[model samples]
Target: MQATLMIYDGTAAPDSEIPRTGGVPLAPEGFIWPLCGDCCGGPMQFFAHLPVEYGVLSVFLCQNNPGSCESWDATAGANRVFLFPPAGLVAVAVPESGVTLLPAVSAIKTQVVTLEPETGDDDELPPDAYDLARSGWEREPGEWFGKQREVLGSLGGSPSYLEDDRLPGCPSCSGTTEFAAHLEEGIDRQTAMNLGGQLGYVFVCRPCSEGAFLTD
Candidate 1:
């Protein structure tokens, strides 16, 4: 059967400056296949590993939000799964707090484990590191999702929300919040899991900010 062959050259890194030629080989059936899509039919990029740090994290702007885009905040609502190069599908359910670390290959080389699921022996994951999500639909409904366009609209896209001295303008009132506090309490690291773990983003207004430890 005379059929055009499709192939993906993973080794051959294509240059961004280089343009594709129409004469290039086209495979009738591509080497790779579609993975997942949003409800609005927008493509979703399933990543291979989770980001250890928050800044370099991968974000999926959901093209399926009704009348708006649903940008799943990785730390807030993303369903993280380790993608295998060979396996067609595998899942690693994560905590609602997001992934802490990509576990090194060990007993979980092939199978994906659900979050905090009691395996009786508890050999699935270590006591300290983070776990991933098995599926997007399996995420907790507590993710406070709002109108994507409206959320960005309130922020003015400052491009420096996380930067030092800059604050992520609140979407509720579109008000600029001051740097509140870093929690000097000695129990911060001691009871990390108790007080919502660690204090990450704690913004407050004039009254709220002053109400905190003003001695500093």
Candidate 2:
């Protein structure tokens, strides 16, 4: 299998039309910033701005009260993912209260990575190919532990180690959603969107123009 890895490429303007994390989200006219519906009921923090083949995915999660918000659940109101038209998107107006945006805008660049599933004993389950590939991303040979910060996430690939029952159903159509991307926290913990130390998953229902987010 193969995956398109999103690599950290430094800072960018908050409203630039580029694939990135921690930037002001761009949305179509009349789009409002999403509020957390699980706990605290405050505004959700903007996480990523990803441009895909069909549209732009604007993701958000609650940081106002992290663990208590159940941000890892696909059906939880604490997190959200929106798919908007590729054009006519403008920087959304930030709300005056609560956590609304990430502290830094980290730009992204893509690199295609080839992944091969590990072969193990018949009784021993192999590690996820995507997870294995992600963990092994290195800038140079034998420098295994130093370059993990450069791996922002991946563009297209199967969910890493996610169970079948956890696949999210679209709220609009009540149909299974397709895997869109995988998200890592970021280069710096202080500036990264909190995921409770879990990898984030993004799913979309193109026909209905809806998206879902979860973590594992």
Candidate 3:
């Protein structure tokens, strides 16, 4: 049983302290761009930049009119999750006219696979450890499905919690929801996001900004 995957690769320049997703946003030089309490007008969709251990958690997602809003429901209004504080970092603030940054950063790497479980003899064990790491990426589905869809998008860590009931609830008050983000599978494979190789997961209930999305 092993699990340590952080293998982005759409570009680079992120490591102000691990926990990343889209890019550009160590916020505070003037920090401004967090107003989509469900489209109070616009400006939401930054989607993650974490830097925890005492600050920095930025996440947003209204997606304009993406499927008539409701983001998923967290409370309706889509998404938003701030936290800042490492002395407030800096830089992010240049939208006097247009703003929606979230597609220009990527290039992490930290593989460490070794969750084996199938060794011939008619192999057939995988029933846990996230299906034995998706059966070791299906034993190389044409190069791990194009490197697992270019390391999908926004997947810093904490997955393979191995079916915590598959995580999802709190459509309003059902409670028990808080995983946050990991939509992965996209770096432009023609608009990726298939997840056929598994990943999705977004859960949330932050006071009910409501949200849920599974794919495992």
Q: In model 2, which range of ten residues has the least summed lDDT?
A: 139-148
Which residue ranges in model 1 land beyond 4 Å of their true spot?
1-166, 184-190, 194-199, 206-216
The lDDT for every candidate, in the order shown, is 0.22, 0.86, 0.53
Candidate 2 — number of clashing residue pairs?
A: 0
Extract clashing residue pairs from model 2.
none
| Whole-model lDDT, model 3 | 0.53
1-216 per-residue lDDT for model 1 (tens digits): 011111111211111111111111111222232222323443332211111111111212222232232223222221221212322322322223322221111010111223443244555433211111212112456754321111100101112124543443432344664433221111123211111222222333332211111111
Residue pairs in clash, model 1? 5-27, 6-27, 92-132, 93-132, 93-133, 93-134, 94-131, 94-132, 94-133, 192-197
All candidates: CA RMSD in angstroms? 23.0, 1.6, 14.9
Which runs in model 3 stand beyond 4 Å of their true positions? 1-42, 46-99, 104-135, 138-146, 149-159, 162-171, 174-182, 185-200, 204-209, 212-216
> Global lDDT for candidate 1?
0.22
User: What clash count does candidate 3 reach?
Assistant: 11
lDDT winner among the candidates? 2
